[model samples]
Target: MATPLWLAGCVAAPKPSVQATLPPAPPPTLAPVEVEPAAPATQPASLFTLITQGPVSAMLSYSEKVRSLNGNELNAELARLGEPGDVPTAQMQTALALAQTRVPADLARAVGLLQRVAANTSAEARPLHPLARMLAARYLEQRRIEDDRDRQVAQLRDAQRRIDQLNDRIEALRAIERSFARPANGAAAAPASNGAKPAP
Candidate 1:
């Protein structure tokens, strides 16, 4: 069978290639990220801040007040503290005030109070324990120093007294020697006037 020339000519034309080569995809571009600067790391609270703001701050403040008090005021404070009371804070404050007096009896009382505080095992009193123990140790050391000083003072006084006694004894011996050197008459032995020997 003979096909139509025009249709055959159209079919004979080579089919255009279906696969067209495409330009390689441009390298993927990353948009610049606007990252917010990380917030500066927060610094830890300092010891001074902790001390000033922590549970012990009240005691520290009260102690400062106690330290600033005059003798008469401190005495009055002691008198007030002597009244019957069982509050730990009050007890601590009283102990602090007593410690400042430097009187043996008062210091003894303060040490006792501090010891009580340090010995407390309850959770409520735990915060005070360290401070109390530290204060008690310091006061005990101070007491030892004071006792040493008193002992030394007593020793010095005794030494001085013994020296005085020895001095008195030496003076007595000198007096006896002088008495023996004198003639039988109560008159003192006098030196001859011109280096001339006295008549035998």
Candidate 2:
């Protein structure tokens, strides 16, 4: 059967086109990273351990040894210091020991040694300088205190002597007063006896 021209034209027209669909793309991969291991925790060093292990260790050790020595050993140590060796450590040890003795002569010697050590500006003596200066200062203060105490003791002795003298003077004055009183009483009795009696 024959159709209309418009309907024939519509049939001859191409059917509606359908578009193809594609799957979604995958995410990009990242590079791997390296991580470092953590370090272990550590405690801080103590002051005692630090002082005992460093350049000044020998001096400190020798000082401690001197401190621990008995009377005989201590005297031996002091006698040893008088020998030919002028070692800094030995000097420090001797000074420390002498300081402990608390004798005026020994303290004076210790102060001299400490001052010598403190005065040395050499690199070898640097470690001992601080300790030496500190010890010297302490000994100086002790000497000053001792001098003040001695002066005070002398003043007290003088004051006591003066007080004793004053007491003696007071006793002498009291004796003199007693003597005068006795003589006055006797004189009064003599006057009374010499005077005429009153009529009854």
The per-prediction tally of clashing pairs is 0, 0
Query: How do the predictions measure up, each by TM-score?
Result: 0.63, 0.61
Q: How much does each candidate deviate from the true structure in C-alpha RMSD?
A: 11.9, 13.6
lDDT of 2 by residue, 94-164 (tens): 78888767689989999988777777776756788888888889899999999899999999999999999
Shift in Å, residue 110, candidate 2: 1.0
Model 1, span 84-198: residue lDDT tens: 2555556677889998887998899899988887777766568888888898999999999999999999999999999999999999999999888777544333444355666
Q: Quantify all predictions' global Cα lDDT against the true fold.
A: 0.77, 0.75
Q: How displaced is residue 29 in candidate 2, in Å?
A: 50
Off by over 4 Å in 2: 1-55, 61-73, 190-200
RMSD of 2: 13.6
Measured by TM-score, how close is model 1 to the native structure?
0.63
Q: How many backbone clashes does candidate 1 have?
A: 0
Worst ten in a row by lDDT for model 1: 40-49
Model 2, CA-based lDDT: 0.75
